[model samples]
Target: MAVLNEEQEMLRDMAREWAVNESPVTEFRKVRASGEPEAFNRDAYATMAQMGWAGIIVPEAHGGSDFGYMSAGLVFEELGKTLTASPLLATTIAASAIALGGSEEQKARWLPKLASGEAIATLAVDEGAAHDPAAIETSVSGGKISGKKTFVHEAHGADLFVVAAKDGLYLVENGAGVTLTTRKLTDQRSHADVTFDGAAADKLAGGGDSLLDDVLDRARVLTAAEMLGMAQQVFDVTLEYLKQRVQFNQVLASFQALQHRMADLFADLAQMRSAVEAGLQAVDSGFGVARAATIAKAEANRVLHTISNQGIQLHGGIGMTDEYDVGFYLKRARVLEASWGSSSFLKDRYASLGGY
Candidate 1:
């Protein structure tokens, strides 16, 4: 088992308390009703920024907290529990790209703003149904890029976009030949289908094929951490329901078959936790990050799907209704599973990396 140090534990507790006190289920319900994917509560985001979450992984020289990936993973897990909609993941992933591959000038310009939440950034990598980096259809010519990128998370609100084109990465300023067509995802977050027509872009210096692969591996692991939180939330909610919900003249928790199911779920959740923690450590240690990330994400994807479905099933008809909260977890799980890469995609990645 991976043990968090005192500082990391404090950070995790802080995020948990904030999510409970400020952005509870009631707040999430309100956000969903607003019909805007970028409709995250600004005050909550400000609070997170104040807590240094936005800069958790950024270097201290860049006005960031300079925490490691494990600490960042804890934050992501906490946010996942509430299905909180924010630019946190996008910003973290983009910042990682810059920190790992961006030139000194790029980091000096973008890192501070990202750490301070002054600018929202997102990665635009998917151009089609596949996750092949080499298959990127977007091409750059004369410092301009053109192509359509689909399923760009939080693109509608991002001030900058870290785009992958022609197997190379570049940063394109928002509205620089970039047009966003928003879509309402299952998770209630805003995903955009972005079209670029000769968009002016600044290429990140020294970002080769390996850099993209490295950053993508980090992204996958971070996503798995988030899914772990979601799965745990589902488990908690269902457990609570079982303890109180009565059927056949007794509480549902008294049934043997249902008890066994919950036990099985607990086992699965434990395995997922182990996988996620190992992946986070691997990312931090720079050891088998890609393969570990693939394993973590693939396992998380499977567990989240099972947990969400079971949560709904245990809740009976109320689970399917919009009035209930479990439906939200189900929806969010589906969206998270599809994001970055799907289970099959990650599995293939794991296989390509050789034995698990």
Candidate 2:
């Protein structure tokens, strides 16, 4: 486990308390039931911004706390526990792009709004069903960007888009020339295929050739943090369930076979936590980020898949029902697993990074 500083511990505790009391899984249920395309409560997002969560990675001069990636990961993990739905992650990823590659004018124009949650932003990359930044077909010409980005996260609520074109990243506001086709995935979160038909774009031209990869590393690490939280919650919930659920005239938790199964899950969860925390720390330290992020996300994909399945099996039939909260974790896990990179994708990338 990563040793947290005093402030980090406080932040983690506060997020945990708020997610449990203020925005529990029931809130996600409400959002899902509302059938809104945004799929998250606007007021809830405003509260998060007010709490300084929206700007954790933003520079202090730009109205953010500049707490770095690990701090942001802490909040993400807490929110993941209760399946809290918000655009915080998407916005943070976009903000990181600007902070890394945006011109001074670009920062002045967008970072403060992003930090204060006065504006919503998202990254538009990958124009396919799978994660593939290298295959981006989006292109910029005459200060306009034209192409489609499939499954853009938080698309419905975004006020700005940090888009990836063949040449580089660009900023496109949500207005004329930008069209959205809503996509409903398993998690029922806000997603859309965005068509940028000659949308005016401002290029971000400062982070050198590796800017996109750096931003993506941030996304992968932060996402793994969220998965860590979900895996932990599922393990906790399943363990508690086993203690109470009786089978064959004895408590299921007491069964040696079931105990061993849970023990295995516990070990996997521990490894996932380590990889995720190390990834977050690596981002903060600016050390071997690509390798660390790949390992973190790969571990997250592997462990969460197993734990979510085991959560269902240990609970027997009830785990599949909507009434059970464990089912929600599984649904959300599947979507996240496919988001930045799948296990196979990360493994290949890791090998390439190692020059194998």
* Location of the lowest summed lDDT over 10 successive residues in candidate 1: 127-136
Top-scoring candidate (TM-score)? 2
- lDDT score of residue 75 within candidate 2: 98
Q: Ten-residue segment with the worst summed lDDT in candidate 2?
A: 244-253
What lDDT would candidate 1 get against the real structure? 0.88
Query: Against the unseen true structure, what C-alpha lDDT does each candidate score?
Result: 0.88, 0.95
Query: Which regions in candidate 2 have their CA more than 4 angstroms from the true location?
Result: none
lDDT tens per residue, model 2, 143-199: 999999999999999999999999999999999999999999999999999999999
Overlapping backbone residue pairs in candidate 2 total: 0
Q: What is the lDDT of residue 144 in candidate 1?
A: 95
Alpha carbon lDDT of residue 1, candidate 1? 57
Count of backbone collisions within predicted model 1 = 0
Positional deviation of 255 in candidate 1, in angstroms? 0.8
